[model samples]
Target: MNSAEFRAVFRYIQALLIITQASLVLTDHREMLPPSPADINWLMHEWTPTVVRETNYSHRAIIPARNSQTRAAIAKVTTCDASAALTAQFFTEVEPAVRWLRSIYVV
Candidate 1:
């Protein structure tokens, strides 16, 4: 994704958060990622920990965490860089991912 595409996706995500009636299943099935860790960081920056803390809607982000560009993403959330604690978990499979969402129960 280019910067504009990234920003568009970011805005879309932010828009999704505006609706508070349901859960969000965010599946990033992209075969590749935009060539910038800075964009990833910007995205994380845009979606703040306060949003995670405040929103009642649950989200399941099915991202390829350990072995991809999202490795940086995984590290960012896992470390909670500068208190940017995104409320997401990484999963390579669906069963455990579902279990995790159920386990959290954001509602």
Candidate 2:
């Protein structure tokens, strides 16, 4: 997707994040190109912080590693997660990923 398309999607995700106490960002950039530095920076500076601050509980991502390109994008998001508390991790499947995210809430 192009920058504008990326921004629009991110905005929608960010808005959903803002209204929820805890949430998941399901980013499967399957056929799409890996995000640009501008996209990564937008997540770092804008999207992540906004979501982290908005959500009262944990926020996580389930970005399946469909390819090396997707893995790289997950890595960037994972790094950003360290500071934002929006934990982004890659998985090959959905079930285990969602299970892990739910496990985070258990006391």
**TM-score per model over all chains:** 0.60, 0.72
**Model 1 agreement with the true structure over 1-107: per-residue lDDT tens digits:** 68778667656665667674445555544454533666666646555454455554355556564446556564564455533334566677777877777776654
Q: What is candidate 2's TM-score against the reference?
A: 0.72
| Best by the TM-score measure | 2
RMSD of each: 3.7, 2.9
Model 2 clash tally? 0
**What shift in Å separates residue 66 of candidate 1 from its native position after superposition?**
7.3
How does residue 96 of candidate 2 score in lDDT?
73
Find the 10 residues in a row with the least total lDDT in model 1.
Answer: 77-86
